[model samples]
Target: MTTPSTLPAAPGPTPAPAPAAVPAPLPRRRRRAPKAPSALLSRAGVTALLALATLYTLLPLTWLLLSSTKSRADLFGTNGFAPGREMHLAENLEQLITADGGVYLRWILNTVAYAGVGALLAAVFGVAAGYAFDKLAFPGKERLFSLVLLGVMVPGTALAIPLFLLAAEAGLVNTFWSVFLPGLVFPFGVYLARVFSASHVPDEVLEAARMDGASEFRAFRTIAFPMLAPGFVTIFLFQFTQIWNSFFLPLVMLSDQDLYPVNLGLYVWYSSALSQGHPEDYLLAVVGSLVAVAPLIAVFLMLQRFWKSGMTAGAVK
Candidate 1:
């Protein structure tokens, strides 16, 4: 039976069922949300803040300026910011110069000596030490640097008594050296010098200088010094300001009035005016303050360019 035409052709081998049709997936097109702009304060708000800060800083100085021009009666009687009936700026200057047999001039000279010479020496010392610290290798270098950093944290007031004691032992108390010598060891200046040296002075330049038959000191003096000039000026200005405004150190060291710096002199005048019931002395004090601030202003103006350069020397790459 199977051989007979394959039994109806074996039902054509039971033809396979047609496969079900499947749809293709659509291409995914993801849509992203737009980002919002960042919020910022208006320009007016920033300008207002800066103007407020400037007013706060300059308000006192403006009051002092106005006060310096007032007469003794007007100084206390009138509003601090108002002009007096009679301008006494000229009279105040005369009195300031002639007081205590011209002792204020002595104070000015003493301040110059202490601040100028001391700052110069301190710059020299600081720059040399910083260069050595940055470039030279020695045992205990890091430890010594750490000590210098520690010194930076110690306030000048804390060191005044010890410095006075040391000066007394060295027979320098009640002398100009007592005040001047202490101004020569500014740890902050050294720290700044080190930072400047590290950032501004390259090792390869120094090495090249050495290869040109320059000794260490010669190399520093010729090559490194030029590179470190901005740093030196920065250190000098810092030390100068510190020495100029120093009061406690001079108070502890100098017993003689002729050796007083401007700050101590002003303090003495202010204290005497308070205790002696002398109202004119109060006007004198105000005038003296104005006079004292003049030099600092002049110095800042004169050295503004150098100061700016020095301050920003190591800031950028």
Candidate 2:
């Protein structure tokens, strides 16, 4: 009976455990100040550089435009940007056309033939070579491609002599074939074509074509060539411009004025002008150059869409 009445322990105040130390918030990393001034300065510098580059490219053309309108006296006397007292562009063009028994027209025709035909063949040949290189498994493929790369690195100037010799051996020197033949072999076009073929021509599509009983050439012609049309335009434009501007090769290859490209023809006339100090000759060259550049501008404007597509071909979707 005595053990049945146990009392509970009395409640007592107890000290609170010392507060756990709060970690000091890490010092906020000081945000770097914006380099607004330096950034502005860098942007300004780049903008200025590009502006200068544009000005540099356009300045000559502007001068050519202005000078072509000037009379011989005005060309030397007027401010380069200023229009002349009278427009002589018509007079200059007439003179250019009639000069030296109308040899300038002959040169223009020759240039068209060389650049136009050569570029077409070059594009096809390069694209085919590149397609074969990328798609076909053949012995000496890499080795042959290496040679093409080596050819690319070697400047046309370096090859002029060797080519001249080869043409001489073949009795093609001083003929249209001399300049036209060399322009057809475009190493850079081949390289670009390989890249384009690798990017644009899917292996799956080619395999599917094979499965459908299409021969390799038929697949290439029907399926691949259409895909590579932009690339063809690109290569054609490049080689066409190259052959159009080609001077040294033509100068070395051709002794006959009849076979001279427009560029070479101009060189001959310009040299004659310098030797004789003929203002009329100088005026003729200016007009001729202006005329010559028009075709290039037209071609580029017409084909810019294809060129842009070709350039951005390998971009991810």
lDDT minimum window of 10 residues, candidate 2:
34-43
TM-score of each: 0.86, 0.89
Alpha carbon RMSD to native, model 2: 5.0
Which digits, one per residue and each the tens of the lDDT, describe model 1 over residues 1-317? 36544344334477789999888989889887766543335577677888999999999889989999888889889998788999888988999999989998998999999998999999999999998999889999999999999999999999999998899889999998899888889898888888889988899998898888899999889888898888888888889888999999999999899999989998988988999987777777888889888887887788778878877765784
lDDT of each: 0.88, 0.90
Q: Report lDDT (Cα) of residue 5, candidate 2.
A: 72
After superposing candidate 2 on the true structure, give the runs of residues whose Cα lies further than 4 Å from its correct spot. Answer: 1-29, 37-45, 314-316
lDDT score, residue 9, model 1? 38
Best by lDDT: 2
Error of 1 at 50 (Å): 1.9
Q: What does each candidate score in C-alpha RMSD? A: 4.4, 5.0
Q: Report the error of model 2 at residue 99, Å.
A: 1.2
